[model samples]
Target: MKDAAFGALLAIQFLTRLPVPLACPWTPATRRWAARAYPLVGLLVGTLVAIAGSLLQGLLPPPLLALALLSLWVALTGGLHLDGLMDLADALGSNTPLERRWAIMKDAQVGSFAVLALVFHLAWKGALLWALLAAGASPWWLVPVIVLGRLGAVGLLVAVPAARGEGLAHAWQQSLTRRDLVLAAVIPLALSAWVPGGAWLALGLAAFIIVYGLAVRRAFGGINGDIVGAAIEGGELWLLLIAWSWWSFAMA
Candidate 1:
């Protein structure tokens, strides 16, 4: 029980900007168990963002409210996934061999491709949120989308072969067992019981997980931390797109 509690804290500590009052142990076993709690971290982030959006829904214009929500989203995660997205974008856009592309991803300096990807990513998120707000959709829609994003991350961690022999992803992968995946999946499974169109959403997420994992494998020969982070951001965007499209279809 104590180790599990500390594992949760370790996950929260590593994944978010939120300060954990308790010190989580820095150990391999702890990090391994920590992955199981990743979905819960997403739930926490999503719930807080939803509540904030609900409170601010009518007070601010849709545009500004969307901006505020987006800001909060980025602030909470400290742009960790965004940085990975940027790094991957730089690597992909470098038009070099895989080895050189990997090197570019390691570079500290941001490139034009990274800048462009950042703008597009932020713009799409803000635009989609603003549209949803204007349509009077419940901000609670964010809960599943955000939760699924991290679930996607966890899914990737286990599914993709670790490209490198080192780093956090590899260590977590090495420690993972099927039981660990079973535990990690429990959150989403419970969440599906309540989320609308849950079955369909699960199907979509599964497909994304499979395709995204393979794409990473083919492009980079396997997965790493950056690829997993990219999966999160990409998964979130896909969910948002689905929401917006569904709304449009219903209205049309």
Candidate 2:
């Protein structure tokens, strides 16, 4: 459990750029638990964003508040996932073959497609979050959704093959055993029980996993860090959009 906790914290540090100190030592054994640990990082990221959004609620206008929280959320993770989303977008927009697309992603320079994709993603996220706030969904609800989305991404890492020859995805490609999935599944499942209508949230997460798995299989030929990152962003954005839409309709 301690090792798992440390792995979780390490993941949080990796994902969010958090300044927490290392509580446990790193080891080869730690790598085995990486899949389980990754989502906990999302949990922390979501919690922080919700807190920021909640605090900013009274001070800023709805759109600005959402944008502020969204910026903080991306900055926390160093926009790591967003970067993936942009690269993937650029690759997809290209007319080249798969190998060529992968090569393009490796290029350090951002292309026009990447720039436009980043703008759209950030704009979409900002608008979605702003709508959620205006709809009066509790900030508490947002945190679990974030956790679910990230956990869903990790699940994808376990379920899919690596698209490239080597990278972070390759490291954990087959390393995630059954025990790892169990541990990864349990934490979020337990947390979901605590939120209002949380079971439905879990159901939504399941749907996301299914859809993401199919998409990854068809699109990337396998899962990579970029796809996982895109999955995380997609999960979060979709959940917020769902919540906002549901709440708005309920009020109407």
Sliding window of 10 residues with minimal summed lDDT for model 1: 243-252
lDDT of 2: 0.77
Over 1-252, each residue of candidate 1 has an lDDT whose tens digit, in order, gives: 777788889988878999999977877678767888888998999999999999998899999999999999999999999999999999999989999988998898999999999999999999998887787677888888888788888888877888889877897787777677779878887786687655555667888999988887888888888888878888888888777666666655
**Candidate 2, residues 73-179: lDDT per residue as tens digits?**
88888988888888888888897888898888778889999899888878888887878788777666777777787788777877777887798777766567667
lDDT assessment of candidate 1: 0.85
- How well does each candidate superpose onto the true structure, as a TM-score? 0.95, 0.90
Taken over the whole model, the C-alpha lDDT of each candidate is 0.85, 0.77
Candidate No. with top TM-score: 1
CA RMSD of each candidate after superposition: 1.5, 2.2
Question: Evaluated with lDDT, which candidate comes out highest?
Answer: 1
Candidate 2 lowest-lDDT run of ten: 24-33
